[model samples]
Target: MKKRDILFFSAAFVLALLFGCGNGSSQHSFALGDSTFMLDNKPYQIISGEIHYPRVPREAWRARMKMAKAMGLNTIGTYVFWNLHEPEKGKFDFSGNNDIAAFVKIAKEEGLWVILRPSPYVCAEWEFGGYPYWLQNEKGLEVRSREEKYLSEYKKYINEVGKQLAPLQVNHGGNIIMVQVENEYGSYGADKVYLEMNRKMFVDAGFDGLLYTCDPEKDIVKGHLAGLMPAINGQDNPAKVKQAVRNLNEGKGPFFIAEWYPAWFDWWGTPHHKVPASQYTGKLDTVLQAGISINMYMFHGGSTRGFMNGANFRDTIPFEPQISSYDYDAPLDEAGNATDKFMKFRAVIARHLPKGEKLPDVPAAKPSMALNAITFDKEIGIFDYVGPGKVNENPLTFEDMNQAYGYMIYQTKVTGGAKTELKINGLRDYGIVFIDGVRKGILDRRLGQESMMLKVPAGTHSLEIFVENMGRINFGPNLLKNKKGIVGEVTFGGKVLKSWTMFSLPFDKVETSKIKETKSAKQTPVLKLASFEVAKPLDTYLDFRKWGKGVVWVNGHNLGKYWSIGPQQTVYLPAEWLKKGKNEIVILELNKPEINQLSSLEQPILDQMSDNK
Candidate 1:
């Protein structure tokens, strides 16, 4: 056996001595003490790395965990996105990539402990901040608050996730060591009662292990529960962060950094976020020397596939959707390969390991291939693939239409009022305005424009507005009111427009074969299809470098979107999603069919910031 294996077993043997082995008893517990967290009645410091399961392919979970372990991290931290598990109300899915229990089991098999932050309201740049869109449909339901309606639903989700994870706690002979309650609540609101309620709900649902609260340093005290262990996030000043945690923990000695950001996240049309290893290593070293535990926010950030990506906006910044890549400039790149940052971090971790201990070997890089351009042989117009929709008196929100994600079209007629200015109230993101089936103006929320002046001719004319969800706010005070599509009213020259025909284009799934074929040289949105053969399957990126703004699909799976004005020009196509012999691709070109062919690139172009950036 390896020396490291021997050392690990020795520690386990000691734990077994203190607490009985095999289906451990209550005595074999992980508890929170004033000064330290006790495991098997001994102080233990958790060294963890965060990785979201849905963002990663199920086949790669073990490999990623192995990478985390190889980096000397003893624990794995992850948030359970509620929207993914329970896409609709009372409908829960825990199979495949949504399998929380299986993920925890894999972590245990890898000899790593787990820290579950099943926030349910996890603001991880995920659509709707992990809240189900159905929640918005609840007549008076206020999320992240003391609202009974919201709490009841929150309870159901918490119970479901808990049932899958609680039995796997270390006390029950499993690896889960900690459970965080209501992530960064204080940053959104200061509700002590709400935080306590979340804690109670977690306990009622069966999570009896080390329960805690994690928030930024500014919101730590406000979000913290009186008896719960309070952890700080994001701050780099070790002394100040330690002091803050100590103060919150009642002069405690054990300090924890719940989220140590090695790098920041990127928004669409913005430059990729990066930080030199030198920027964080010195601070990391200081924390380790001080004996403080930490969980690297994203040891590896994978792709935010499909429509799961989120958006963000502040006073200065407008509504900006995050690119599909959740790379975060992490030590491990989006494809799960190590970068220079990885080597630098590994060296730092090795130097900090307990005396005579060693980290496992880093895994090898995954294979990638570059193929020649894929010429689309078949094409169809957007109208050829229109699904069934409803007609409302006025334009309704996506949630109002029972739609979760994707685009929606609102068409109305301009009759009496020859309005100069047209306004769409509560326009979530981007909208393309047209009159008489001709494109006139584009109202992009990112540019802080929601209204446009229409040069309408006399008599009744067709008024069409095609709006993209862009993405719902995944963080901040907007989390509660994040209803996509036009929320309230549509006005023309201060006149409330009535009687509308709306179409739901909630591209949940597209059937390429079912779509009718049509060819037209006229400028309009088109769907293009192509096929290619590969002898062996290897990971490759679908190059949309030549294509305009639109979504891509491979073998009936949505690969997410790409835009001409982009920092992301390619969509990652995992080998698991590829076929051994023949592979197929379908692109739903949104604006213009500039090209009839698409190419595959050996690498991704995720840092080419757009013009408006």
Candidate 2:
């Protein structure tokens, strides 16, 4: 049903050959035909699973690849997070966990091909859709646009990524068979010119392998270019998926599902989403029977560590920040253990592997440890750890101060109106208003409340607003405008507030030695210190069910945030970070520190997704 006629840019291919661009020590060739792709001119089917290199630790990359191979997968797909690769403009770090080339090379060693989705803009519920925080300050630089300012920066980043990956392409005698162009662009806009530019950029950067555009079935036509191959996403209906792909590619036979959602991601205050196996099983079978290629969106979703989690703002939802755990309820759990779904999926995948090629043996489970309740006796006042702040005439946004993540404090003097109407125009997220170090009121964006009537205690009262960078918006129309902290002017009683001393507490400078011991905190947001001893280092989840909302640090490494209002009661702590005998834990409790005991659980309480909504 599919045409085998080769369709390619002859000039580019010839140039690639002449320049020895496609030449490599390992000999292999990959090219796109009408219906299906070809390996050495033979029809090939890509049975792949998506996994992020940065999400999983560098030590775990090989094991994860083996897990995928054992599940009867021939290919492993990954997105090259632009922000992770290049946190700042012109500053690139490919070492440690950011070593994508190493990840790919490991996949090759595990006998698996790779699909590189290097989107300068990756909307994987990542901070600012993977755009660097510095981009916000660039005037007139609209992100995800074809505008010069944005594109110029993007070109440099993509070129850098290419430098790391182009030579590893399948045509270059490497395992990287295909490289995606501008991830799911059609879902965002109907700009053909933009898609075209992205395709050209890939070719220019030395990716001579198959280049394709993946879009939602509905938007495939809008997102696709004339020459590039089109793939559908989030569509389980085999008939519809095939129809969509064929319609776009003039009756092309072999269909590919770019992102097959096994389960969905979770937000802070909402129930975790799950797709029952029964619901997706039949569709998966139908597609496999029809000979369609699919890449499970997330085969294994590791933690969204640090402040990289993104938020979701829908029609009714205000702004829901994603929880640290990216555990998408996939075949592999957050801890990389195989779920029941994994076994079942393996059974299904086994039915369609190439002749005589068998799946590898599943790896043994990693041991987890349970520890006794450790008490936190020492206490530190949060106010004592304040960094040297700068004085400004007006409060600056987090981007203005070049502070990317964590919290910021805006302190100034307020007077005049007795019941002053305090308004924080464009408040980024949760902000607690304090008058002269006393808690006055709370201004939260979730409740859709911004302006609060403040009772200005006579004369000049010290006004302090502590704002936390909850998370940046990851997808949709509001993506380009996701700047943390306050964006616009703060007005009180029709008068613009000025002459403010702001603290840029990015928390990157958080050190245990720097904090002073205190007897007690008068109010909420107090820092507590505790130490626990482990027989030996083993993987454990730090349970914070007793504590209120805030963050936890284990041996100076942030375990991420936890709240009483949780589907997530504990943060995952890798064994590598835990020392043998004594381990120190620090918690910055935002609300009441009701419990002082800290314990580690062998199992994680991730799916409590009740009506915390």
Candidate 3:
């Protein structure tokens, strides 16, 4: 060879090495229309598991991701809840549990791929379906629409999230391969323009990764974009799913199941639901056998915590709230423990892996503890306990009371002569009215009526009304500005009552810890506390069967509500929250004394209550 040719070849080799191609293996780039989710034109299959960051504790994230990997999943899919990250419109939180960028980085370090599903509107059955309540306060702001106000806010959220995740895409040497546009938009409406607008926003924000739409097969035609890939959701039949994809797209690219439901989510006052493990095993086997790629709807469903659970208003006349535990019967339980379903799914995936492929070992489930009861004496009356002269003129709405989240109390004085016909003109939801220290009547929003006949002794008598803000209306036309407490007017007999005193009980960790014993002079009972030590941690529910409705907090974590009403039996207590030496348990039962005590039972509270009642 010529001397010049040899020098040129050596220089070219050095350049190739500097650019990361000296070994002849090139950097990968994710693209649609390639076989099996091809990146850089090489075949790949994504075994993805869905886990929401806000639902799981930050400390438990790595373990949960390890759990997914151990289940033979190579990818993790998550919904970035807009409401959680940005509780207020302008304010944003990326620290603590909202550290999604950290979570993704951890996934990369653990050798796992990622799919980012950041929805300014994620209907994960979360509070307001993951939309901040403040958005509803904007005048004439239409959600999931082309309205200017909604679009402006949506752009703000998209830009913020994009800034956090754009550099993490596959093209940027990170694990994120694809980004999903608006979740299941077709099921809600066939507004193609709105869908395109969302897609353009993602691209404009500098997310160059392949974008796609995930919707049930039937809705794909209306939801999917012409150039982008369409992933099917919840369909188990591989052949039918492939055919559906082909029909929708003229057989252009690889088929993917973006959301395969391993199990369903539960609501408070509803039976604990479980889908047989055997059924899921068979379904997953069939899909993998056909060489199709898939992602579990939730490999691990975590808790909604606090007042974040969304409600549905479909069957009944009014809206019903969702329970806090999002334990969707997935392969991974709320506590991150592997169920029988997990083992079966793992075995199935292992059987299909190429030669030399092996899954990691599953992590051991965390510990849980059962606590002993702590009892306290009642002293203060609910009305008399109010601070001196801090009352308002009219009953304050939940918002006006600065109580954006929980229960509120309204007290007023009735000054008319003994009136038999007592009426509360506009009661928002459920309310219990007490005259002088005796229960007068119950007003339910379900019936949309609030008139009660009371035996009143003429002249000045204290009238106390307690109202609970049930879960907000999650779907349909009523979703706009769901304000709790009384919305309209309150009348007693023929005359209206004024000069009201309002108390806000937006329970916080500090307030819960400083709870004081009720002052005896007052009538309402103080919430009780109890503690007990167990030899080892065990998952158990603080049985609310014998108690009236209210909230429960164990080790400062809200375990959701337990009502004496027929339905939900057990509230989930993750072993992670309990300490072996000692654990504290507190209950805020609505009506007290008669059913004050709680017991720990092996069976779910719903079943046990059903059997006993």
Candidate 4:
């Protein structure tokens, strides 16, 4: 049971009053107690749902928060993805969808308390676990540890996050009540000293109010800190979840479930994961009946747009990359619409609301459009526009060459006219083989296939392999070194292949204005494009089941990658990025251009599994 009491940190409360008075906004006090959480000397129950700012568009932030409240959420949980905020080494991006402060502010506007999980490393199945790709290039840097170089880089970014969000804390006249320490660290390692150091970093960055660490049931003991509150994640047993945290929290009573999953995420080559609401609403009821403070892992799981989705790989499991749609099948769909789960969860929550308080009306469904097939006729030869290549005696990994996402073209001269067994020692993810602009075979790291036999015309022929970085490993021990492209040597006829010209084509921005019309590209890679007009823009799904493997862009905004593989056959195109006039769509097709036409659907085709294997 929760107990409403006086302030736990008197000094911080007084400071909050001062700050709040300065801003002319009514201030609120939130404190952690031995048995209950106190909000203004009264017990406060936090019913939160995790939502990422980067996943949802900037224009739809308020609408999403409204949806959360309508579903009976009192607070919102969010992870500030470091990679999305700071893509480069020294440069930082907090504008547009990366504007986390804006997201939090909107949450407050919608009457929701904020739980800021500003992660130096957040394993939300995000690329590199939300660690910036540039971190891989740092010399002698070890992640999620107390390594000097690693901590030093982290301090800068954490301070920047503090500068943006700390003042908006609940104590300081804003709705931010709790801030989490290094996300789910015990799932990876047990280093109390390292975690303590991380906690201190948060304090120095001005997150001195209500700090906590959350981990799985088995890991709570290992990741627990004696000084801060310990929260459990992934535990469904209400009584067990309460007891586990109570025993470890020095006899505290207010239990918090950090990540309660209603459903799971899907990867390529798997069926879409859907959890029936009836299966989990009873558990939600049990948690509320026990007075446990809980947060849904994803009240809404939006799209993992562009190359931001993550992958899973370890000794136990094979290389499995996450699909483009992050739509975790939560109460809110990927496009931010209510589902059957939403109605059921809302009913369960409505029964537990305080007297005289009722859940708001669910928002109207956002509009969606279905249009005719948008044919892509114009083609651009990718090889001709590959600009230049860096010469190297050996193959350069994606990180070594200072590249992150997209394809890396490795070109070299090879003896032809004879059947030679070609082998690549370290193909990171997936690649398309070509000899003098003609398709030969494919090498996929997921399938563990490295060697393929090829025979080209006589004389020296250009050997080219287009390697696509599916996504970096987001969990487990393998994530420390998720370098894309070729990590080892390429050999033919059992002889080491050398003298490479590496082309780093991340395609951060696709420039297709200078395209030349081609008759056809049945055997090589090509840039596919199409243009369409809309009097009024609305949300639509770019149905890509007919398309082969490639990355997509609409009006220069990256929509992310697509494959012939299962689970994800369409990319979510938001109306926010659309316009009232003409819009252009671009695709970088790596394989055969079999896509003569593809339609924009009114609804997503997420469960359309293919037997492409």
Best by lDDT: 4
**Per-residue C-alpha lDDT of model 4 across residues 509-543, encoded as one tens digit per residue:** 87787565754655667787788888898999988
- Give the Å shift of residue 154 in candidate 2: 0.6
Question: How many steric clashes does model 1 contain?
Answer: 0
TM-score of each: 0.93, 0.92, 0.85, 0.95
The C-alpha stretches of model 2 lying farther than 4 A from their native spots are 1-25, 416-419, 593-595, 609-613
Model 4 alpha-carbon miss at residue 541, Å: 0.9
User: lDDT of each structure?
Assistant: 0.83, 0.81, 0.74, 0.86
Predicted structure 4, TM vs. truth: 0.95
Clashing pairs in 1: none
Model 4 stretches with alpha carbons more than 4 Å out:
1-25
Candidate 4 or 1, higher TM-score: 4
Model 2: per-residue Cα lDDT at residue 369: 91
Rank the models by TM-score, top first.
4, 1, 2, 3
lDDT of 3 by residue, 201-257 (tens): 999887878888888888888778777788898887988788878876667558899
Model 2 is weakest, by summed lDDT over 10 consecutive residues, at 16-25
Using alpha carbons, what is the TM-score of model 2? Answer: 0.92
Best by TM-score: 4
State the weakest 10-residue window (summed lDDT) of model 1: 18-27
